[model samples]
Target chain A: MSDVKKFMYVNRKAPYGTIYALESLEVVLISAAFDQDVSLAFVDDGVYQIMKGTKTDGIGMKNFSPVYNALGDYDITKLYVEQESLDERGLTLDDLMDIKYEDEDDDWAEKPSIKVVSRKEMADVMDQQDVLMSF
Target chain B: MKLSVLVNEGPYQHQASDSALLFTKAALEKGHEIFRVFFYHDGVNNGTRFTVPPQDDRNLQESWTALQAEHELDLVVCIAAAQRRGILDENEAERQGKDGNNIAPGFRISGLGQLVEAGIESDRLVVFGD
Candidate 1:
């Protein structure tokens, strides 16, 4: 019931090997703290951000992917995955974590009460939000 | 309307900076006011004056400098991030006993408050990152 606006975070980089994912996550958390309606879309290498079972200890980096699961507690549950990106990377819904999915065919269908989706569908959803931030 | 832009990736490392520049220009062209640009993490490198790209390249640092000059944009680099990366202004370089300053003009070293203020002041906050 908060009057806060809506925001869409477009993530396009891999979770690790760079600071983009970490910084983007921080921004999302901060935006959520303001009571904004927050959503996230993963495209390109960014899909790796929500992949299951990651271990970064060998690289002296902590595995932060687990923190993503806690986003729902902040009311940031809208997570999407680009269909083409998944197909190109040979990934399936099973390869990702538990979230909603938005396929191209479901554009006009009721948003599945879930969190996965395709890039084209994500663009449409982004247009509905007050702000679209890409990372 | 006022817009706050967040640039989180270094210039040329990805298309983030270019995209941000384009967005800023487009927003201005539409008669919008830019509240501020908060450069964080690796994005602080965009303000480094010592960077020189190859002769055949488009000098991104110079491009940013030009944008700042032309638009009088508020370019803010995070103090913590810049210090960790060895980018310092005249006062910071002198305080840290560095040989000279590496950060260019028109960019100020600031804290996270600038980002918060920008968010509060702008009607829209657009982030361009890696």
Candidate 2:
């Protein structure tokens, strides 16, 4: 009913081990329909949610990793990854899936959505959000 | 302040449900408006009418039901997550052709959009999860 509110979905748990990661994505996808200013913050083991080559065949779980690719189409693009979390996990930006969004304002130019930020920067992002949904 | 709460864990297995209930009660006592309380993931279990805890232990479902009645709260369980975990309401039971539905009083099965709407409408959205 009101103007758009800044929503940040803070993810901290590992994917698959718990249902948090997938369920958080479900809420993220649904939030797109509300025309809110939404962004995602991946810290701790949550960084694993976007890792490339996620194989769940032996585990017999639905590999929902591919669903992250469809996020760009939902008009939800900002994904802030904490640099410290990646370093502690021995992961690099290259380890993540290449999620891109087509910028409508720039003649539909493709741009990478995942922005690697320092812990301090991530804190600032969280500080500015009107609503924070943690998982 | 207007607030919305999201619960992401089951009743007895985790403390999230209890914490959320206490937090909601505290907020209500302080004269704050609770826009909605959205249940997701294993949190949908809190809406089951058949949960029978020990006599000494708190009946979380009934507690939540009573709270909702007192405050006129909007207690919503995510429909997709509920269906996956077998938490069907009357309409859902008939739609899915299930034999029974176990949704407790004062809680309704709805869409994930309700969660988003809660986030947008509330002054603060407090999440109770792992």
Candidate 3:
């Protein structure tokens, strides 16, 4: 486990228009079993993937938004959201789903996983990663 | 340095597969060790042996197969993605009750864990995609 590499899944596409988001999520789920230091970054249209109240009934596609809530259980608590992308898209943190994780180091206290950061901070996050897979 | 390559786009429709192949070739030429080449998403299409591009145009699958044959490269096609895209090996074809398999030579169907392992073991995990 000491060899855990920093794996970042960069999401820059919309949820359903293309298969990128779904496929990227699939990889993330599979990666959870590896016990690596994994993180998910939401930028551009990818921000919509975690948006609150995403209903797919009319679109005839499976709504995978709820899966974000389960990521914390998979030991993937780092969900970095780009503020610039949300701002450009006229969205705010309130528009996103509330994803929280239980902090075992803090007496199992529940903590929010989504972290809104400026573009500069997002760049730093990308720079600190050992592996970057953009979808 | 040890490196791993991830190709997320299909052949012909996008330049990702070609870029990854060229990059891997160049890296090997420079004396770098390629740990593995993982094909995911539409990239699994690159492992299909049914592709027959125009005679004048370069056949990407054949190119990858030839390079793999020469270098003994570990070419992996993601099983989930391959199933979705219909790129199956002989074993998978039988397991899935399919009548045929079209996976190109030197390519093996595997899970996404192979990609995660590649990332963890390789010095650099270069992803070529949109």
Candidate 4:
């Protein structure tokens, strides 16, 4: 196998309604397990995945926001939110879990070195990756 | 670098397609080559030729068609998903004995091999799915 060192995972779906969120999370965990440098970004409705205190029991689904916290155990700690997405949804940093907030900055301001970026910056970040997988 | 982009959401249904388009445009602008763009699940709707969004609104299908024409982008719709959703090309419509094909030009009917090929050949395979 080639020594692929970096990976970026972009999540673009809501949490409960479909399999995209869950499967994307699984893929991130698996990529991190292989010791690849993994980072995740949430765009559009995907921002819901990291919202604080999500309760899914009323909808007959298991609460899964806790998985966000568990991501730290796998060393896949670079979690990003598109600034435009947050602004469009009227969400602030306090409304989210413990994740680095970045807006077009390639360098992040949190643990695990995951940078949050804007839609415009995605191409540059993507270009720097050895492996990029979106879910 | 080789690249594969997975588009899972339908055009105009959400921002996923827009973001995917922007990403593809940016990737190309930066001199990166896209190996393939795979449409899975509801994304196959992107290949529909019958789409006619209200004249007042933006026509995403036209935008995608323009992109394909401009770059000769490899647009592939998953056969399984397209079949389930009734989006068929001429070959597929004939093979399945359907009356007609509704898929748009510049879009081809293909399988997971295109996706696998992207994963294997590209330096990175990014997905834009919902």
Number of backbone collisions per candidate = 8, 0, 0, 1
Per-residue accuracy of model 2 over A14-118 as CA lDDT, tens digit each: 899988899999999999999889999999998999999999999999999888888999999999999999999999999999999999999999999999999
User: Which residue ranges in model 3 land beyond 4 Å of their true spot?
Assistant: none
- Which candidate leads the pack in DockQ? 2
Which residue pairs collide, candidate 3?
none
DockQ of every candidate:
0.26, 0.87, 0.71, 0.16
Root-mean-square deviation per candidate: 6.7, 1.0, 1.1, 9.3
Question: Model 1 over residues A1-135: C-alpha lDDT tens digits?
Answer: 335666677788897777778877877777665766777888889888888878888899878886787775666667877888888999987888664333346563433323556667877887888767665
List where candidate 2 sits over 4 angstroms from the true fold. none
- Is candidate 1 or 4 superior in TM-score? 1
Local distance difference test, each candidate: 0.78, 0.94, 0.94, 0.75
Q: Identify the superior model by DockQ, candidate 1 or candidate 2.
A: 2
- Ranked by DockQ from best down, the candidates are 2, 3, 1, 4
Question: Over the full model, what C-alpha lDDT does candidate 2 score relative to the true structure?
Answer: 0.94
> In terms of docking quality, how is candidate 1 classified?
acceptable
For model 3 the local lDDT of residue B75 reads 98
lDDT tens digits by residue: candidate 1, B29-115? 898899898898888999898988899988777877787888899999988778978889999999899999989878889876576
lDDT of 3 at B89: 92
